[model samples]
Each structure stands twice: as structure tokens, then as C-alpha cells.
Target chain A: DAGVTQSPTHLIKTRGQQVTLRCSPKSGHDTVSWYQQALGQGPQFIFQYYEEEERQRGNFPDRFSGHQFPNYSSELNVNALLLGDSALYLCASSWDRGDEQYFGPGTRLTVT
Target chain B: QKEVEQDPGPLSVPEGAIVSLNCTYSNSAFQYFMWYRQYSRKGPELLMYTYSSGNKEDGRFTAQVDKSSKYISLFIRDSQPSDSATYLCAMRERSGSARQLTFGSGTQLTVLP
Candidate 1:
């Protein structure tokens, strides 16, 4: 069985540009969540998607958005990126009602 | 103050030693606790999960949660070089539908051979 997978292992974007990252949740999972981890810091929650809709969000600004497809894959889009937007973007998957979640390898976004 | 607090330790120890990592939280509503191990530049890998206050052990790793004190801990027995990684403690409220996790700064462990 395949676990959660993410595309574009690494990326480099200029300031004020936009970047899109993709994620495919683990098999048999339905919910997808996004997180941002800065160097030497723990991951901070971005948002969560369930049933193809964003269910909950964190303290991040509106520049960050996400989508969950019917197949349980997810995409995280960041607009007008700043240098602070550079970090490792992680995707986690779990059951809609289950408590535990599994994560993917993550996409490293570098806003230069 | 932040909701969760953890000592970001660059803890170094010799092989075969027991390692203990801990985190404290101010939110009493958080009912699900987790411990994740992350390698450099990698996403977190779930090591253990606990629903409520209690102790759960798996192989060389053990997790403990104390709801009254709002503290959680992860213990590694007979640590090895391969166990060296950043250990993160995460928790979330039980009532939420999305259940987004709040994480600590992570403790970096280096088990020297």
C-alpha cells in the first residue's frame, strides 16, 4: 500500500510570486491537512480539507489556501509569497473521524 | 503565552542510554497526544499516539500523557544512532472536526556511537 505522496521535492520562487504544491493522501484515507515547518521549528498548521471543502484553518493569512479533491488529493497554494514563506510544506492524511494522521515527505519551498 | 511549550533540546547521549522527551501545554481541551520523529529536512513520522491520559509502550519507545498536569512525554529505551532525529510532540482538541495539530519546536537527539 502506498503512503501519502507529494510532488516537486523542492521549489524556488521569487518574492511576490505564487507557488502551488500538490499532495496525494495515503490509500484508504479521506482527509488532508497542510502544515509549514520553518528551519529549526516545529510544523505550524495551515489548514485542513475534508469532503472537498476547507474545514478548519490556522492563524495564517489569507494568502494561504488549499483544496481537497474527490479522490482525497490536496493542493496548497500560496500567493504573493515572501521570504518568510520559505519552509517545508507537509501534508498529512487521516480518516475523517479518526484521530491519528500519517504524513508525507513534504515539499520544500524556497522563496528567494 | 503559546498553547504548547517544549524544551528544544539538542540532546546528545551515548548509545544504549535511555532518552526522555517532554512537552507541556496550557490547553486542557487537547485530548489526543502524539509523538513524531522527523529527520533532517523530512516530514514528521508518527511514532506514537495516545487518546487520553495514560501510558502506551511500543518496542523501545514509550509515551505517557497526564491530563491533570497537561504534560506529555516520550521515552526511548536503548537508543541507537538511528534514533537520532528531531522528536516533536503534537496535540489537538477532541471536539474539532478538522483536528489540526499544534506542535512543539522539537527536540533534536543525537545518539553517538
Candidate 2:
């Protein structure tokens, strides 16, 4: 089966601009979650999407949002990007809540 | 203090050596512990997982959790060059709904041939 997949392996954005990253969960998966991994750091949870609605969120601000579609694909949007927003955005999917998550290759976002 | 703390080691070891990686957490509510291996420029891949405490082994990987001490460990036997990567420790609390995982800074390992 195909594993999780993400689009635009890399991206570049300037301050005050917005960017969207896409993800397709592994086949037979239903929930999608997003994470941000800064340089020399582990990934921090952003938010999670289930049933086309946000199920849970982490410590992130309102500027970080996400959507889950009927097909179980997901998109993460970050608005008013700051230089600190530059990091590897990772997408993870699981069959259900409280299950092991599988991660995608991630999209590297660079805020210039 | 951070929920979880791990040593970010650029630890170097010779091939065929046994490698031990570990992490400590301050949250007692975290019941599920996991270890993920991530290569440079790639997302993390789940390597081992354990519920509550005790040990689970998969091939060369053995994951151990000590709930009493709030500590978790990953042991790799006969390590190879391919085993070199950043090992991340993640945990989440048991809940009926989805919960966000808290991760550690990850330890980088280099198995030299």
C-alpha cells in the first residue's frame, strides 16, 4: 500500500505571505494531523483533522489551520508567515484516534 | 520544563555495536510511548511503540518503557550504517478522541563502518 504522501517537497515564502501544504494519508487511513519540526528540534504538533472537522489542536496559534477532505487528504495553511515559521512541515495519519501515526516525507517551508 | 527531554547526541559508534537511546517525560498521563527514526530531510517513521510499560521487541529493535520512572528506551542490536539517523521519542495520553503527541529533541546516531 502507498504510504503517506505530501506535495511540493519544498516551498519558499516571504514574510506576511501565506502558504498551503497538502497531504494524502496512507490508504485505509481516516485521520490526518500536522506537525512542525524546526532545525535541531523534534516535531511539535500543530493540529488534527477528522471527519472533515478539526478534532484537536496543539499549542499553535490561530494562524495555523488545517482541513481534512472526504478522501482523507489534508492541507495545512499557515498565514502571515514569520522567519521562525521556516521548518519542516510534516503530515501524519492514523486509522483512528489514539493509534500509531505514520508520517509523510514533509514539506520544507522557508520563510525569507 | 518541557514535557519530554532527550539527549541530542551526535553519538558515533562502530558497526555491529549495540546502541541504546532513551528519553524521559514529566507527564504521567502519557501512556503511549513511541520511537521514530528520521533520516536527514525526511519525515520520521515509526520504529517502535509500547503502551503503558514493559518491553516489545521487533527484529533488532527492543523498546522498553518504565512507567514508574517515566522513562522509555530503544535498543538496537548489531547496528548497521543504515541505522544511523535521528531517533525521536514521542508520547500521548490515552483518550477517547485524538490527542496531539509531545516529542523530544531526538538523538542523532552515526554508525561508522
Candidate 3:
């Protein structure tokens, strides 16, 4: 009955650097989505992965990418990080695009 | 204009008081509405969700949606200190395969003992 879990509670990166954050979806869930929450703001959708392929994406630039594994785990990668990339990266999982989503503790990315 | 709009209220109230939080959206296609409670440095936890338009209640929490007005509300009765957190409103269209949600800026509530 474990819920969604994310790795590396926090991370620090610099400009032109790349980082990868990991997520393990809740048990019995198959779809994984990523979001970015800046300080004092609500989370913005980054992208969603279903069937090991990216199914939907938000207004984010190409620097952001994600992958979903056969086991329903996910990873979010950001390349050429900028100072603005500093934010909380959250991972959410649902079942077959279910109405409800469960989120993980999130990885705090600090771009220095 | 943003798809969803909410007041980022650092609303402070005495314990046992009733608290009300609201959000308005510009998108009529959004059919699924949700309220999430987020503690500092933590991911949001879903509080309530409503499909279409109606009222749903769970314990001290009540959620109301007015589709015609494109507004949604969350009411807390007999609030406690544990209820103090940032409340976020999120919604999504029903027709999408991905069903990505659009979220509000979140309202921060503090229930003083």
C-alpha cells in the first residue's frame, strides 16, 4: 500500500547542467505525470506519461522531458538548467487517467 | 486571462471558526474540479473532487461547484490547527486522454489556537 515516492529529496545544479529526478508511482497505478511548483504558486503541469510514452505536455520548453518505465515509475530530466528552473518538482500518479491523482513528496531543485 | 484564478489568502482565523475558500475559472470545458491541501515543503493532497456541478461533503470539509458561474468553493467547519495549509483548486477537461489539470495560486489558511 505504498504511495507515490520520489528520490533525492533535494538537488542543486548550476547553469548548463542537467539533472534527473526519479518517481515511483503508487501501487496499482499506471500513469505518471510531472509538475513544477514555484515558490508561492500553484503547480504547473509539465507532462504526462502513459504506456511508456509521453501522452500530453504543457507549455514547458523542450528542455524538460520525462520517461515512464514499464513498471510505472517515472523520471523527469531538465537540461541546460537556468536560475528559473529552481522549483519543487512533483510527481503524480493515477490509474488510466482516473479523476483523482496521488502526488509524491516532490524533489526540490535548486538551480544555482 | 489565466484559465483558473484564486485568491492567495494568508487567511487567519480563530479555532472553531468556519473558513471558506473559492476559485473561479475561465474555461467552460473543465468538468472535473478538485481541492488539494498542501503543507509547506510537501506535495498537495487531494481533499475533495466533484464532477460536473454539485455539492459534496466529507466530515468538516464541504465542496461546492457552480458550473454556470464557473466558480468552486471549499468550506471548512470547526477548523483546527491541523487544517492550516495552502488550499489549491485544480480542474481538468473531461475529454482529454491525458487529463492534465490546471491549478490555482493556492490560498494559505492559518487557524490560530
Candidate 4:
């Protein structure tokens, strides 16, 4: 089966702009989670979505938001981006909350 | 200090040597432990996972969790150059809809041939 798929392998944006990245979960998966990986740092959880509703959110500000579609696809939106926002954004998918998750290639965003 | 602490080593070792990677966490509430491997410019891939203070082995990879000491480790036996990558430790307090994970800075393992 195809693994989790993310769109626009790379992205570039300027400060104060908005950007949207998309992810499609692996087949037969229902839960999706987003993570941000900064240079030389481990990924930090941004949020999780289940049943098209956001189930959990991390310490990110209001500018970082997400949505899950009925088809198990997800979209991560960042508003008013900062240079610090330049990082790799990863999306993970799992069948249920208790199972291991599968991650996608991630979208590398460079905010200049 | 960070909740999870790890040495971001660009550790180098012989291809056939045994490799040990570790992480320590300050939160005793963490109940599940996992190891993830990531190649450069890629997202991390799950390697092994454990729920209790014990060892779980899969092939040449073994994950050990020591709840009492708030420590966990990943061991790679008969390591290959293919195993050269970054190893990250992750954990969660519990399971459910709120299954958010905390991650540690990855250690870069370089298995030289």
C-alpha cells in the first residue's frame, strides 16, 4: 500500500504570509498527527486529528491550525509565518490511537 | 532542562560493532517508549517500541525501558552501514485520543565500513 503522502515536497514563504500543507493518510488509517522538526532538533507535536475533529493540540500558537477531512486527509495551515517557522513539517497516520504510526516524507518549509 | 534528554552524538563505529543509544526523561508519567530512525532530510521511522520496564527485541534491534530510573535505550547488534542514521527517543504518558508524543534530539549514528 502507498505510505502517507504529503504535498509540495518543499515550500518557500515570506514573513507574515500564510501557507497550507496537505497530507493523505495511509490506507485504512483514521488518525493523523502533525509535527514540526527544527534544524538540529527533534520533532515537536503540533496536534492530532481523529474523526475529522482535532483531538489534541500542542503548545503552538493560534497561527498554527489543522483540519482533517472525512477521507482521512489532513491539512496543516500556518498563518503569519516567521523565519523561525522554517522547518520540516511531518505528518503521521495510524489506524487507532493505541497503534504505531506511519509518517510521511514531510514538507520542508523555508520561511525567509 | 528538557523533559527528554539525549546526546546528539555523531557517533562513529565499525560496521559489525554493537551500538547502544540512550535517552533519559524527567517525567515519570511517561509509560510508553519508542525509538525512531531517520535518514538525512527524512521524517523519522519507528524502529522499536516498549511499554514497560523491560526489553523488546526485534531482529538485531532491542529496546529497553527502565521506568524506575526514568531511562530507555536502543541497541543495534551486528550493525550495518545501512543503519547509519539518526536515532530519536519518544514517549507518551498514556494512550487514547490525546496520544501526543514528546521527542528527544536525535543521535547521529555513523556505521563505518
Error of 4 at A50 (Å): 0.8
Question: Tens digits of per-residue lDDT for model 4 on B1-113?
Answer: 99999999989999999999999999888998889999999978999988989899999999998899998999999999999999999998874566778999999999999
Q: Per-residue lDDT of B3-88 in model 1, one digit per residue for the tens? A: 88989989999999999999999999999999999998888999999997889999999999999999999999999999999999
Model 1: runs farther than 4 Å from truth? none
**Top candidate by TM-score:** 3
TM-scores, one per candidate: 0.98, 0.98, 0.99, 0.98
Per-residue CA lDDT of candidate 3, range A13-111, in tens?
Answer: 988999999999999999999999999999999999999999999999999998888898999999999999999999999999477998999999999
Whole-model Cα lDDT per candidate?
Answer: 0.95, 0.94, 0.95, 0.93
lDDT of 2 by residue, B13-77 (tens): 99999999999999989989899999999999999888967899999999999999999999999
Ranking by TM-score: 3, 1, 2, 4
The number of the candidate with the highest lDDT is: 3
Span of ten consecutive residues with least summed lDDT in model 1 chain B: B91-100
Report model 3's TM-score to 2 decimal places: 0.99
TM-score (0 to 1) for chain A, all models? Answer: 0.98, 0.97, 0.98, 0.97
Better of 2 and 4 by DockQ: 2
Could you list the CA RMSD of all candidates, in the order they appear? 0.7, 0.9, 0.6, 1.0
lDDT accuracy of residue B61 in candidate 3: 96
Each model's iRMS: 0.6, 0.7, 0.5, 1.0
Q: 1 or 3, which is superior by lDDT? A: 3
DockQ of 2: 0.88
| Residues A1-112 of candidate 4: C-alpha lDDT, one tens digit per residue | 9999999899999999999999999999999999999988999999999999999999999999999998999999999999999999999998874558778999999999
Candidates sorted by lDDT, best first: 3, 1, 2, 4
